[model samples]
Target: MPDLAQSTFILPQDATLTSEQSALEQRIWAFINDNHNTTSTHLLIISGDAGAGKSVVLDAAFAQLQKAARATSGELAGTDNKLLVNHNEMLKIYKEIAGTKSYFRKKDFMKPTPFINAYRKAGKRADVVLIDEGHLLLTMPDPYNKFRGHNQLADILQLARVVVLVFDFHQLVKLKSFWTPALLKRVTRDYAVTHYHLTEQMRVGDAAVNDWIDHFVRGKMLPLPHPQHFDFQVFSDGQPMYDLIQRRDAETGLSRMVATADYPFTVLGGKTWYVQAGSLRLPWDKINFTDRPWAQRPETLHEVGSIYTIQGFDLNYAGVILGPSLGYDPSKDRLTVDLAQYQDKEAFKKRPDLADTTDAKAAIIMNAINILLKRAKHGLYLYAADPALRQRLLQLAK
Candidate 1:
């Protein structure tokens, strides 16, 4: 357990933007104003890596949109605008941010499914719609999510005059919501399309270490560079790392341990479950019953988080416990993934049209690792379940 108490809500970053971010927001605003009443729809795809400040830019631009929607004058005056996100945890954070602002309403933020279904039934179209974590939008009918539409993005395009989407290819983790750059291009080919690729890296502070992480995510095993502005450490054992994370949590706040879903557990098992590796043992992130995110919850210090709860969020120091599904192939002198060891079956669900599921399975697991590894803004703590993999990372750390 950590010295930090059960948590308070971590609000979105302040509404300030760098010059580059502000210029992008200005372009987005102009597009919305220009197309709000146009006969044809338009799309602006904001592409970036994780922690590239795409969400931050969107929030700033959306604040201006909301202001115009409720205003009495101006081109955007009385126009309708909505913010959409497919991730529940992220949705909670956005709505919380809305609730705190006088000009904003919680209702302005919603999931893509309900928003699409409601507006279509009401025979209404929006002036503009902004989607965060657009990579998570269902690309096919997912009846379980109450989304029976062929594709959520397509549905939104039909119901909006202008659509702005925050997308990252590396964040695609599930077969149902799988997306690729080619697929994105094909979908918006008929629309008046523009793209803004964010160049800034907002989370990790060190450039060399950031490069190492990028190579790791792409399956190119190489030496880890010595970091100047970042704290990067590798641990052969998880328990000691857990202690350091707890200490960091006490000093800095918002620090927690998160792992890939490589252990045996089910959401409906109706029993207490734990993640155990050697002498390190702890419960998985508790089923989040509060509005605060799993990492923001005070009790989460004692619980290991998963991709479901931690994606699209940031922390001061993220203690990453690499799980069993990942390993190293010393023979091939590279990293490897064992799909059988991956515990999240939902991520590997059969997609009828998906070719090369084997490759995709490995990619999804690596994607989860990428999301976990980049959560820390200042430092990162690390542990690996497989001894061979741990040894490989240790060698690279040297």
Candidate 2:
């Protein structure tokens, strides 16, 4: 297997931080400096919505911490003393900004028994661990992870002296993800936990567009009262929407098509179902891992991506396909989800209390759609799979 820490990509230094980001960076530094030599563990949770600039703040902090560690000739004055874990694509971005020497996946850090055993064998423990997309941290045990812990968060807290987690609870789209306020409090009972919030929008510039997105994602059936600066459109068909995206990509770059897993497809054997919008037929792209970037690849333009591939990334324009699973009630003027048409197998697994109830399932589907809708920075082009829904969107567009 290839070493995960080694990367050739480097992020440009021109990314500027907003005021909120600058304040958060100072606080993170203060937290690290205060707890540098603490015997017990400390946890700092930075919570923010999408486009809140968590990654940018952390990237800047990482660079500063690295510089500080280099200047000091102490036990923690090196890269090995700190560890950074995130999704593969996120880590790649960080690698470009900070370089690759201390990167690991969340799964690798969650196997506490093995991680600790190896560390003990080497006679060292990590001083700090930085986690991005902390909501995506898994709690479920699998064949590869035989860790003796309740969840990944617990295991990570045990392995490091100080842990910094950047998370957004709303982005919890997976079944096994273990990020809730109650869960966080329960797991961090033994550690000193500090919470910080990031509020400024960094990805989408228009506040009206953000508000409209929030309203739509919350299952509002009302028509969007057009925003001033954002460019949002609803198309009757998918081909024109895709054409707009392709044109935008050619002109400005970072535009792609994404959708929910409403169609039938095989994960293995490289089989895929086509998303048809009138004369348009496009293959749905399989779920790509954190290491493999679907949106950044040129071939992805010809494919439709799911929430898994496009989440945590920003685009200039996004062409979204609201598949058959999600529908519109013309009589009620509200959004509805058909549980039967929903095809995300992992999302179908429900908690014992919510078993057999469509409420939870519907919420997940809506959340997935919300995430897809908010991905575009400057523009959003949408096409509903159901004719009724398409007609409704068209009426709203007019």
Candidate 3:
């Protein structure tokens, strides 16, 4: 599917960004323009909180680069193969670029294709390489030495002349770094970073709503207004939330129903459900149907769409379960969610309770929730068992 079709990639431009964000974007542009003439190794890492316009700026910058490179095609300094890593949108770009129905279904291992092996070998330089949700590129191994994903993009990272990694620190899930403080730390230490903090949020309609999500993602999120169409409501009886979910669910009829780390069912009626992976496999014979197709009876459940899947997707209604993952941490003097276990298999083996750090996971979870909730043409519903959680919801809606 195309990134435009995906809910995550198709960002709505409803609100204007703040002066700070605009300044940051200009600075980044200047840096790129200044280095546009340089032949030295150019790597730019753009980091921001979720909902900040990293992708938005990237879209504009990429378009400019494509225009410039195309204008100076033959006389330019680099190859015509401008490699772009589109995550879920990769297939879309390839289809559009090739302008044909092409599928990688063949089992032949040796013979390489033009589109397939653009960056297959080392010293294979390209005008530029762009990676989205870039944190996924970093995958370190545990003591077991097991690999994460088969596509070891080490070659692509090393080969690209001008490589750009765009991502949010809050969304770092199961990153692999060798003795680094955090994924961002590793990147900043390695490259001549041109930091751009995207503060103005265009996702949530209200400034208060943006602030709520920002705080959930980072510890402290300031209030910033957004454009219209971004609106939300938190319901106590589940009626408001459920009704909204049902409407959207009726439209799609749960065909794209998904499970999350939170619950057994991908979606109940309209609202998406989530549960910790550890809890799903408990002795009660609790099975996880997350990311799987919907089953007939209780044993069959819908699959949880990864953050990448929902990047450009949205739901009519979204229900979030705090479960045992999040709690009030006195040390932080704020809500603390332990999400370290969500992606760490080894850590899960040691401490099972940290499996669902609800607070830490809140922003990403809620961001996913927003992906679903914003799909509503009419309304949105939110439910949290904890009273404080419920109150927080009220604050967001108001």
Best by TM-score: 1
- TM-score of model number 2: 0.85
The numbered model that scores best in lDDT is: 1
Q: Model 1 shows how many backbone clashes?
A: 2
- Rank by TM-score (best first): 1, 2, 3
lDDT tens readout by residue for model 2, 1-398: 22222111222345456778889999998999889688899999999878777867776676677666665575447534443543555544544333344432223232234554466567675777777777777655533344444477787787778888888867777655634577778888989999999988866757877887787777666565577767789988788888999999899777898887887776778667877765678998866654546677777889988877777777788888888987877677777789899788776655553335455566668778877887877888888888888888888777
lDDT of each: 0.85, 0.71, 0.42
Choose 1 or 3, whichever is better by lDDT. Answer: 1
Candidate 2: where are CA atoms >4 Å away?
1-12, 72-76, 79-86, 95-124, 144-148, 286-292, 330-332, 350-359
**How displaced is residue 55 in candidate 3, in Å?**
2.2
Cα shift from native, residue 104, model 1 (Å):
1.1
lDDT value, residue 290 of candidate 3: 40
**lDDT tens digits, residues 6-63, model 3?**
2333233554435665565466555655554445546677776555556656545554
Which window of ten consecutive residues has the lowest lDDT sum in model 1?
2-11
In order of listing, the candidates' clash counts read 2, 3, 30
> What's the residue-level lDDT of 387 in candidate 3?
57
Candidate 1 lDDT by residue in tens digits, 179-279:
87778878888899988999888788887777888988777788877677788999889899999999998998889999999987778867878897658
